[model samples]
Target: MTTRARATVTVSWPEANTRRLARQHLAAPAPSASASASPAEAVGAMLGAHAQVLSAAELSVGLRGDGLTRTDVRAALWAEGTGESGRTTLVKTFGPRGTVHLLPVADLSLWTGALSAVPTGPNLFSKDARMTPDQVEAVVAAVGDALQGVELTVDELSDEVVARTGPWAGDLVMPAFQTMWPRWRQVLHLAGHRGALAYAPNRGRKATYTNPGCTPMPGPAALAALVERYLYAYGPATPAHFARWLAAPKRWAAEQFASSAASGAIEEVEFADEGSAWVVAGDTDFPDEPARGVRLLPYFDAFTIASHPRERLFPGTAYERALGGGQAGNYPVLLVDGTVAGVWHQRRSGRRIAVTVEPLKPLPAPRLRDLEEQVERVAAIMEGTAELTVGTVTVGPHA
Candidate 1:
């Protein structure tokens, strides 16, 4: 097979088992020819940098029972204990542009500080944007008043700005300030940073803000530790990934990369197909064997979104559909021999699970059988029966 054909592997495994593996991979000190550690800790350690954010996404694909929307995905994470004690905490900010993501409790402070200190460049939040420091301060004050100690959504906060400052306050709102609602959130996501917001469960079984109070951002040392964690979890990675993840300038990420390299926190390896990605200090043992069967990955899973130059995991042709038109397309896919072969679904009639297979390319008979057997295993786990149809899977209401 061409290298592209062999880049990534998608397989079916229990969500709990996968998380256990992630923990195991992340915790081991370094890769060894014959190290004896449980797969659970290693997997956790692997995801520890992003705080197991990637693993949670993968979990959604396996257990959420399909037909997930964007909001549905987030809700799933929350249910799985988004930032809860035992689970990876999705720190409101850590990656590029204050996007909310899971971060390990251990590394929070370091990443938070590094990101906060980094200057926002030509981006809207940059020093010279429409909103000055005073304006931001005023807005913050108004937001506090409007919340009246209540939590609010981004929309609600924006509305308060309009009401207090006048209709034109809405109109005259600086582009940067306006952009900050979403964009600047990235700025705040630095390792030690925290928002003064309070979250509550909404009707849709997801988190909603009830209070707008801000949380204190972490101190310098704490932020540094967070950055170190990122290197540990996803190192050997290039500055670009770090830059995008933290919204930090490429230079800052580069500097961090050098520091991490010097400390032996991360290592780099170019793959036959996928190119180089940062692996943790001892993650050299990332499974090279073919992942057993088709894995239904949830949208936005970390492995899918892990880094740039993703040649290691996805082929050029697959992207047309996998990420159709640049929107992260969410398709149920088939993992054949450790690479994505096609998309699939499951149907239910009474007690049986009917699986539909739509292959991007043809498969050999033996491979097809392997896929069927794997499907049966999934069915057995879900329904206590191995009787399954693999030709065309879809989901129907429970009988």
Candidate 2:
């Protein structure tokens, strides 16, 4: 048998920054267009928007497209999208990283299929709180059937699930927020991953669940596709980085890459000074120019959360200042010339938004002007005027 040579490309860290920014639609100005992109469309490209904080998620999507506002984002998500079929274009659910996200309806097939197959490592719940594989499937099926035409609050859904599965499913086993959660509720994200249900709108401060009406494509193929998507969006990455991003087992992630390499599903790159990384086969057009600009990324922004080479992304004092114990997305960051240069905070008052930036290092006069422009852009996205202040951000992480 003859082995083939995998096409390899050389990329410096600076070049990697350029390609990543362009892929994420942050390298240049938001393009002026006759038809504005829908929030779903914008989010679908980035995979999905981290919606742990719904307002922050809205801003995350609002900043990426041509003239999208918080109002537009909210409307697209809540006005029509419910767990039921044909409710909306976007469905709020448990997506990548097993956190809340706004996934596009059109791509739910891929999302659900891919997410269901991610290896679940280290079960966190007590033995009593955990569900057997068979029990989880039963709950997923019952949840899917119960949510077909009606939305249910968390309590209501719990009742329905327990009624269908009997008392063992309702045993309190998992600890959360100073309380124990039922065994059935432990699989809420699993249900979402299986196309059984998704998060519905809050019913007066209480979260609800509904059917997303999706059919999951669960198989090795689906998982492979997700790897491809990740590479396209955040490529030149290693299995270790991919594992961390998806919260999958490290060995399993490496197996996926190793098999893909053998099958030519992915190509290897000699990322300069960063060792070897992989890109989707045929995705080799790495930009030569370095990414340079100023941007304001809110808490849990995908760029900072999912991208790799963390040391490069959060260089110098940024690692200690912005990250929380080596975890990204705790503090909103200031991006200058494609790396974290500072931290910032924003306060909204009526039609005005006040922004305060604390630079880790001295920013040039031109960079300051660029940052001012970014502040104005953020204000526009929030439908207000922005005032820029280069003072200290008094608040702490996740504040």
Candidate 3:
């Protein structure tokens, strides 16, 4: 048999940054409103947006879309108006890294199927916690049945789960996020990732859960699809990056990458810092010039979370300022020429918003002007006025 060698391409840091900015819709302001006419279309381009903070997720989409408002994002999430008037095209669920995300409703099958395939290991529960496989399945089924045609808070659903299953389900508690989480409730997060459940509009200030109304794709096929989508949006990237992003085991992630490479679904590339990476096959084109502008990205924005080679994205003192303690999404980021330059936060009073930026280094006049324009856009999204302040400020976990 004849042997064929896979092709490899080299990309400089500047070129890679330009490609990422363009693909993520941060290269320049979108040319027309039609480019991102709807929330679903905007989110689909980036695969999915980080949504641990609902307001940040809304701003992520709003910033990408031309003339999109917070109201538009809310309408897509809740299906607010009459028939064909307010469409519920997006759903909130547990996604990559077991974190909350806003995914296109149409792609739930793929997301659920791929995420469910990740091997969580033998001891999924704590040593003291008692939860068998059958009991877990029962809890999952009870959650689905309880959520049918109705939305229930986590506490309410826990009650229903205990009723249908047993008190043992309620007794299994484990520590999480500085509090004890009932083991039965853990399945609820899995259920969302499995496409059996989704978040509904809150009642007053309480969060609610409901059925997502989609069938999950089979496990193996879904992983393959997810691999392709990840490469398209975040490559050229290493298997380790993909594994870390998904919170999946390194071996499984490597297997998926190898499988994709063998099939010519993705091709190897020479990345500036990573040495070797992979990008979607035949996707080698990049802009002639690097992206230039200032952007105020909200906490957990897709652009901040998805990019790899952290040093390149967060150069010099930016690493500590934007991602202190090695954690992403802790604070809003200031982007100068497609790189993290500082951290920021906003305070709202009636119809006005005051934005405080803490830059790692001094910014020139042009960059400062560009940042002012971004503040105006943020204020417009909130339907209020804005005031900008360039000075030191404490934000994020350590603060």
Best by lDDT: 2
What are the models' TM-scores? Answer: 0.57, 0.93, 0.94
Residue 70 of model 3: what lDDT? 81
TM-score winner: 3
lDDT of 2 by residue, 123-153 (tens): 7776656778899889889889889878899
Per-model C-alpha RMSD: 10.0, 2.5, 2.2
Candidate 2: which stretches are off by over 4 Å? 1-7, 34-37, 79-87
lDDT of 3 by residue, 1-399 (tens): 966464468887788887887777777665375555478877877778888778788888888877887888888888776256535899999888878889998998998999888877556666668577898789888888989889999889989989999888887487788888776876767888777788999999999999877788999889888888887777888888899788778888999999988888888889887887888889888668987888898888887787888888999888887786766777889988888999999887898888999878898998888888999998877678999999977655423
Tens-digit lDDT string for candidate 1 (152-175): 665666686567754533543234
Candidate 3: stretches off by over 4 Å:
1-7, 82-86, 121-125, 176-180
Worst 10 residues of 3 by lDDT: 28-37
Q: For model 2, what is the error of residue 301's alpha carbon versus the real structure, in angstroms, after optimal superposition?
A: 1.0
Ranking by lDDT: 2, 3, 1
Report lDDT (CA) for all predictions: 0.44, 0.84, 0.82
